[model samples]
Target: MLKRYKKYSFLFQELVHRDFTKKYKRTALGIGWSVLSPLLQLLVMKIMLTKFFATGIEHYTTFLFAGNIVFNYYNESTSSGMTALAENSAIISKVNVPKYMFVFSKNISSLISFLLTVVVFFVLAALDGIEFTWKITMLIFPIVCLVLFNIGLGLVLSACYTFFRDLQYLYSIFTFLLMYMSAVFYDISAYSDFAQKLFLLNPIYLFIRYFRKIVMEQTIPTIWFHLLMILDVCIVMIGGFYMYKKYNHDFLYYF
Candidate 1:
C-alpha cells in the first residue's frame, strides 16, 4: 500500500488538496466552517439536552463535544467516501489511478476538519474546568483507530456504492441510528453492567467511550479495551479489503 501511494504520490497530493479546498470554495469563512460547524452543534446540543442529560454530569459540554466530533468525522468521511468513486467517475474511468486513492483522499479531507474541531474541543475543555493530564495524550490511540476504521469502512462503502446508489440514503439513516446509539448527548453510565457491555459492541460508541475515559474520567482503559478497539478495526479492515479485491473489476463496469 505504501508503495502504491509512493508511486502515485503526485496524484495523492493533488487529490488531497482538491478534496480539502473544494469543500469551502465559495464560502466567506471558508476553512473556518471546519471549526464553527461543530461548535454550533455543541452549543445546540448542550442547550437543548442539558437539563436531561447534563444533570450532575461534570464537564458536560466537553463530553458532548468529544462524542459529537468523533461521530461527525466518521459520518463525514464515510459519507463523502461512499461517493468518491461515483463522483469522480469521469476521472476514474479514464485515468489510470487507484480506487482506494479516492477513498483515502476524501477521508484525509474530513480528517482535516475533525482535527480543526479538536483544537476548539481543547479550548472548551479548559473553559469547562476539565483538568488536562498526561493521560489526555492517550486519546491519540482512538483518534488513530477511528482514522483507520473510517478508511476501511470507506473502501467497503465506495465499492458497494458503485453498484447501488440507494446505499447513500440508507447509510445516512444508519448513521443517524449510530449517532443516537453513540450516546453523544446522553449518559450511558446509567445503564446496567450488561447493557454497558453491549455498548462496546458498537465501534462508534467504543471511540466515544475512550474519549470520556481520558478526558472526563482522567484514566486509561485496560489492555483488553485496547485489544477490543484493534479488533473492531481488524474486522472492518479485513472485510473492506476483501470486498475491494473481489470487486475490483466489477467496479469498472458499474462506472
Candidate 2:
C-alpha cells in the first residue's frame, strides 16, 4: 500500500488540494469559517445549555469545545467520504487512480479543518482560565487514533455507499442521534452509572472523553483507556480494509 501511495503521491496531493479548495470556495470567510463555525456552536450551547447541563463543570465552554472539535472531525470526514466514489464517478471511471484515494483526500480536507478548529479550541481554553500543562501533549495519542479511525471508517462507508444509496440519509439520522448521545454539551455524570458505562461504548465519545481528560481535567488517561482506543481503531481498520479489498472491483459497477 505504501508503494502504491508513493507511486501516485502526485495524484493524492492534487486530489487533496482540489478538495480543500472546493470546500471553502466562494465563501466570504473561507477557512475562517472553520474556526468561526465551531466557536459559534460553542456560543449557542453555552447560552442555552450552560445553566442546565454545565452545573458543577468548570470551564464548560472549553469542555464543550473539546468535544465539538473531535466529533465534528469524525462527522465531516465520514460524511464526505461516504460520497467520495459517487461524487468522483466520472474521474474514477476514466482514470487508473486508486478508489480509496478519493476517500482519503476527503478525509485530508476535513482534517485540515479539524486542526484549525482545535487550535481555536486551545485558545478558548486559555481564555476560559484552563491552564496548559505538559499533560496536554498527551492529546496527540487520541488525535492520532481518531484520525486513523476516521480513515478506516471512511473507507468502509464509501464502499457501502457505493452499493446502497439510502445509506447517506440513514447515516445523517444516525449522526444526529450520536451527537446527543456523545454528551457534546452535557455532563455524562448526570446520567446513571450504567448509562455512563454505555456512553463509553461510543468511539466518538471515547475520543471526546480522552481529550477532555487531558485538556479540562489536566490528567493523563489510564493505560487501559489507551489500550481501549487502540483496540477500537484496530477493529474499525481491519473491518474497513477487508471490505474495501473485497469490494473494490464492485465499486466501478455501482458508480
Candidate 3:
C-alpha cells in the first residue's frame, strides 16, 4: 500500500475530479440540484413551523436556512462517506490507490455542495435584510470544524461499512434521528438547563449553534467554543486515522 498521508496529496486532484464528475453524471439540472434540495427543504420547514416559532425569531426562514446549512453538510458527509468505499470496489480491485481517498473524495464532493448551499443561505439572509457584519468572519472557524470532523468521520465510517454491509441503512436512520436531536430546526436553549447541557454534548449541535451565532445573530463565537471544537476534532481525527489505517487492507474483501 502507498504510505499513509502520502496518498491524500498525490491523488488529491484525480480524486476530486472523479468525485465531481461521478456526482452529477446522468442527473438533470446537474449541480443545481445541490442548491435546490436544501433550499426546498428550508422553504417547506419554514412555512410549516413559522406560526409556532414566529414569537421569538422574527425571520423564521433565515433562521431555518442558517441551521439547515450546517445540518445538511453533516448529513451528506456521514451518509456518503459510509458507502464511498463499497461503491468504488471496481477501482479498488484494479488500482493501488489508497482506500481513504475514495472516502475523502465523497466528503469533498459533499463539502462543495455544502458550500454552494451556504452561498444560497447568505443570499436569502441578505434578502431578509440581514446585514453583513465583521462577526460573519466567525463562519470560518465553524467551517474548519466541519472539515476536521467530517474527515475523521468519513474515515471511520468507510472502514466500518467494509465489515458490515447493513450499516449503511442503519446509519441513514441514525443520521435522521441525529438531525432532530441537534439544534437544527429549533434552539436548544429554549429547553430546560439540564436538557440544554445534554444537548451541548452533541457535536452536531455545537457546530450549528456556533455558526448560527455568527451568521444569523452577528455575534462572535466564544474562546471556549473554539477550544472545545478543536479538542473534539483532534480526538476524532487521530482515533479515526489509526482505525482506518489498521483496517485498510481488509476493506477489499468485504467490497
Candidate 4:
C-alpha cells in the first residue's frame, strides 16, 4: 500500500494542497479560524454550561477544550471526506489515480486544521493554570489513534455516500446526537456507574476520555484503553479497506 501511494506521491501532495487551499480560499481569517473557532466554542460552552455541569470540575475550560478539539477533528474529517469521491467525480472519471487518495487528502486537510487548533488548546490549558507535565507529551498516543480512526472512517463514509445519498442527511443528525453523547461539555461522572461504562462504547467518547486523562488528570490511561483504541482503529480500517477494495470500481457507476 505504501508503494502504491508512493507511486503517486506527487498527485497526493497536489490533492492535499488543493484541498487545504480551497478550504481557506477568500476567507478573511483564513487559517486563523482554526484556532479562533474552537476557542470561541469553548467560551460559549463555558458560559452556558458552567453553572450546571462544571461543578466540582477543575480546569473545566481545559477539559472542554480537550474534548471539543478531538470531536471537532473527527466531525470535520469525516464530513468532508464523505463527499470526496462525488465531489471529485470529474477528475476521478478522467484520471486513473487511486480513489482512496481523494479521501486521504480530505483527511489530511482536516488534520492540518486540527493541529492548528491544538496550539490554542495547550495555550488555554496553560492559562487555566494547568501545569505543563511530562504526561502531557502522552497526548500523541490517542491523537495518532484518532487520525487513523478518522481515515478509516472517512473511507467507509465516502464509499457509502457514493452509493446512498441519504447517508449524508442521516449522518448529520447522527453527528449531532454523537456530540451530546460524547460528553464534550457535560461531566460523564454525573451519570450512574452503569451509564458511565456505557459511554465507553462510543469510540469518540473513549478518545476524548483518553485525552482528558492525560491533559487534565496528568496520568496515563490503562493498557486496556490503549488496546481498545487500537482495536477500534483496526476494525474501522479493515472494514473501510474491504469496502474500498470491493466497491472502488463501482463508485464510478454511482458518480
Task: Judge candidate 1 against the unseen true structure and give its global Cα lDDT, from 0 to 1.
Answer: 0.92
Model 2 residue 44 lDDT?
A: 88
lDDT of all predictions, in order shown? 0.92, 0.90, 0.82, 0.92
Clashing pairs in 2: none
Whole-model lDDT, candidate 3? 0.82
Clash counts for the predictions, in order? 0, 0, 0, 0
Q: TM-score of each candidate?
A: 0.98, 0.98, 0.92, 0.98
Q: Is candidate 1 or candidate 3 better by lDDT?
A: 1
lDDT (Cα, tens digit) per residue for candidate 2, span 1-255? 999999999999999999999988999999889888988988887889888888898888888888888989999999999899999999999998888999999999999999888888888889899999899889899989998999999989989999999999999999999999898888888778998989878999999999999988888888888888999999989988999889888888887
Task: Summarize candidate 4's per-residue lDDT along 47-72 as a digit string, tens digits.
Answer: 99899988889998988888899999
The Cα RMSD in angstroms, rounded to one decimal, for candidate 3 relative to the true structure is: 2.2
**lDDT, candidate 1, at 241:** 91
Poorest 10 consecutive residues of model 4 by lDDT? 183-192
Instruction: Superpose all Cα atoms of candidate 4 onto the true structure and report the RMSD in Å to 1 decimal.
Output: 0.9
lDDT of each residue in 1-255, candidate 3, tens digit only = 345657457576677777877788999889998898998898898888777665687566787787788888888887888888888899898988777778788888888999898888889988998888988877888898888799898888888888988888898899889988886777665788999888877888889888778777788867987888888888888877998778878877777
